[model samples]
Structure formats: C-alpha cells, structure tokens
Target: MLRSDAAGNALGAGRLKRMIRYTSLAVALVVAGCATKDDVDDLALDETPAEVMFNEALALRAAGDVEDAANKFSELDRVYPYSEFARKSLINIAYLNFKMGNHSEAIAAAERFTTLYPGNEDSAYALFIIGESYFRQIPDVGRDQAVTGKALQAMREVIQRYPDSEYTKQARQRVRATEDQLAGKEMEVGRYYLTRRNYLASINRFKVVVTNYQTTRHVEEALYRLTESYYALGVVNEAQTAAAVLGHNFPQSEWYQDAYSLLQKGGLEPQESKGSWLSRAFGNMKLL
Candidate 1:
C-alpha cells in the first residue's frame, strides 16, 4: 500500500509540471502575437540600417498603416540622426503626421526639418507644411481668429522666402482666404454691436474691415455698416462720407444702394466730406 501511494504522488507531480510548461508556452506565444508594430520596429532598430527602415516606413505608409509608418520613420531618425535618410525621414514624418490629422505634430516635425536644413531643396515644402497646418486649424469667422492670423503670417513667409516654389501659388490663394476670414470675423463683431445699438463700437469694427480688408468681400458691407453706424451716432457728415466711399468702390453693390437710401432718409446726401479719411483716400479717384 505504501509503494502504490508513492507512485500516485509522483504521477501527480509530473502532470503538474507538464501543465505549467504548457501554460508558459501559451503565454509566450500570446505575447509574441500581441507585440505591436512599434515594438517590432524597436526590436529591429539596432539591426536595421536607416535606409532599410526608411523604405519600410514608406511601404507601411503606402499600405495605409500611417501610425506604424510614422513610428518607423521616427525610429530611423532617432537611431541614425546624421544619415541622409534621417533628413528625408523628417520630411516624411511631417507629411505623414499631417495626413494622419496630427496637425501639431506635423508642424513640429516641419519646423524641425526647416531649422536643421534650411537650405535644403525641400525646405520650402517644410515651410509650406507649417503654413498648411495652421491653415487647416482656422475656425469659423464667428470664432476667434488667432489661428487664421498665424496661418496668414506663415503663408506670407512661404510666399516671400520661396516665391519661385510651386507652393507659392497655393500660399497666395490661402492668404486671400485667410484675409477674407479675418474680415468676416470683424464684420461679425461689427454686426453684433450694431444689433446691440453700440454705434461707436460697431463703427470701429466695420472700419477695420474697410481699411485693412478692402480687397475682401466684407468691404462692401463694412462700408454700408459704417454709414449706418455713423448716422446712428448723429454724425451725418461722416455717414455721408462713408456712403460716398461705398458708392465709389461698389456702385452696383446692394450695400451701396442701402447706404444711399439710409443717408437720404437722414436728410443727408451720399457725397464725400473733404475732412473725412475716406474722402482723403478715395477723393482723388473718380466717383463711380
């Protein structure tokens, strides 16, 4: 009976050891399968050359694995900082991050590239990317326009520094759009103050649109609003001058007709006041 009992104990110990071994094997396999692409890239970093890593990143990007591709490109840059591939990788990283909707990251990468290789042929592209990053973040005209301002500044730099670049054309177009957006914001605020019967405050806002954003579509309406605001403030001469500027700039505009009607209702005519700034600016030109 003692021998049989010992044999039973040995068999049970063997089974327990086999179960532990199988569980460990299964855990290892699961870990291997769960290893992320970044983890794999990390593991290969020491073994892979920068060119190979860059190519891998490109392949991954083309395959629509943008996050992993960005990781691979970043790894290449980190591990081979002075390699030619490193510079190329930074540019790709910027563009890929932009495509991935990581605007801040895109801007950072592009800035880094431009700082490190300002004279490189692709530096214009990096600058363009920075401008585009800010441009894409511009909110509606009714919202704050700080980002629109930034976008305009960046785009202006692109145009001035790289006038011959292909990006310059697009930058010019974006500048116009950004300017219009800023003018729209000013118009929105002016109209809001007008609705609240704040004539002085509203006039200041509309004047910003007229003076700074004259090329924008908001200028016509700004001139009309200025006429209305000046009239409301009992400044009939300034109101008439504002209406005169509106008519001279945009005679066919509905805003001009409205301004003319408003001035006539106030027993004033739409004629330039010699003492007014609008008249000083537009008086030498023939009135339309």
Candidate 2:
C-alpha cells in the first residue's frame, strides 16, 4: 500500500487502492504456478531455453512494455504448451489483455485457466479478476448494464464456488459496491419520474430497490422517496409508516428528518392514537 518506491510520496487513497488491486493480480499469476512443475515430471516444454525466454518476457511486463510482452508470452506458449511457465503465463495473458482494454480476450484467457485448473484455488482469483475487468467497463446506467449484470454473475460464481477464498471476500465487497451503484442509477430514473409528477411510476421503481436491494446504501434514500411518493398519492398512512421506518433505522439521517416533516405535513400526526394504522405499521414505538 505504500505509494512510491523511494521518495515516499503518498498518492491519494484511491490511487493506493488501485495499485494494490492491480499489483496483487500480477503477483498472483507468478505465484500460482511456482510449484506447478512439482506435479508434472516432464512438462512438454523445452526447459532451459523456455525459462530464459519466459524470464525475459516477464521482465518486459515489469517494465510496462505490454504489447511486446504479450507477443513474447504468446510465442512462449506456442513453443512450450504444457510447461509450468506457460500455465502461469496464461494468467498474464488475461491480465495484459485486460490492461490493454481487450475485455473479451481477457475473459477468454481467464476462462481457459479455470477450465483447465478448476481445482486450483488460484482459479477463483482469475474468475473474480475476470469479473472486475468487465465491471470497470460498465456503461452509464441510462445506456445499459448488460456488462454490469454479467460481471456480477461471474463474481457470484467465484463466491459460491470458493467461499473461503480471499478473492471471494474481495468479490463480495465489490458486489456490494456495484449493487449500490446500480441502485443509485435506479433512484436516478425514479427521481426523473417524480420530477415529472409521475408519482406512481417513481414509487414502483424506488420500491423495487427497497425490496430487492435493501442491503445497499441507497435503501434509506429510497425509503425517503417512498415517503414522498405515498404522500403525493394521498396515502398518508403509508407515508408515515415509511418515514417512521426510516427514522427508526437511521435516527440521525437527514433523509429521515425530511421524511418526518413530510409525515406531519401530510396529517399523519405522529402523536395520533398510540395504535394508529401507521403506529401498527411501524411497530413497537411510543410516538405519544
């Protein structure tokens, strides 16, 4: 996580995160196959010459000579198909392809690794990284989330198949972040409908987020929107209920504060009968 090599000039936290993520991937490729030769007596490669060439190509990648490094790796794989170095080299192929923005090629290379070495724990890492390659390229929400959907599916596969893997832990974190991003996109669409006085349509969209993505960071915001939407539709009981839930879950949240004011203005009078409809809806609270 150190920012610089020598002068200790620390980049921002975001830059540090990206550096760790990308470098750990590079390290995983090299480390994964270090002992691969132990399992094979004579891997079909021409050994001495192949090691020299592979080292040179690895160094090229380290120097950031990406295109040339890829060509070298390809040539090495061709000359020595089943060697330990070649197996490890495939991971680099995927990484370099992703770095060069060939997302499909990156995914294909990663798929080859997982297919050939499904039992290898490192394969899970490849799967998660493949998901990340596409996740980073997701289009604006208005355009499409096809790639985002695909990435989520792939990461979910990693988490399901390798529950204990560090990659699975990271994938879970990424999944939560991506889900929140998608939820925010949904909220944006809903807000558009609300702005146009299409309260019912907006309510439906926000409700979907609340029901399906309740774990996301957008849940509180969506609940507040629901409060407004219900009030707009003259559903004062539902509005008060939504506001009370928001308040209970997030006492200090500004969204809850706004929603509370909306509830009172809509005549749900938080101090109505202790067992009023909204009170029953919120459950176990003394609003008197």
lDDT of 2 by residue, 1-288 (tens): 744654454435535654565456555655786534433322233334678879988999999999889877876776666778788788888888888988888899899989887887679878987899878888877766778778888888988998988887889977887787678778999999999999999988888787767788898999899889988998776777677767777778899888878776755643333444434544575442
Instruction: Give per-residue CA lDDT, model 1, range 93-184, as digits (tens).
Output: 99999998999999999999999999999999999999999999999877899999988998999999999999999999999999999999
The TM-score values for the models, in the order shown, are 0.79, 0.67
What Cα-based lDDT does every candidate model obtain?
Answer: 0.87, 0.77
How many backbone collisions does model 2 have? 0
Cα lDDT, model 1, residue 226 = 91
- Model 2 CA deviation exceeding 4 Å by range: 1-56, 62-64, 76-86, 140-142, 269-288
Which parts of model 1 have CA positions greater than 4 angstroms off? 1-47, 280-284
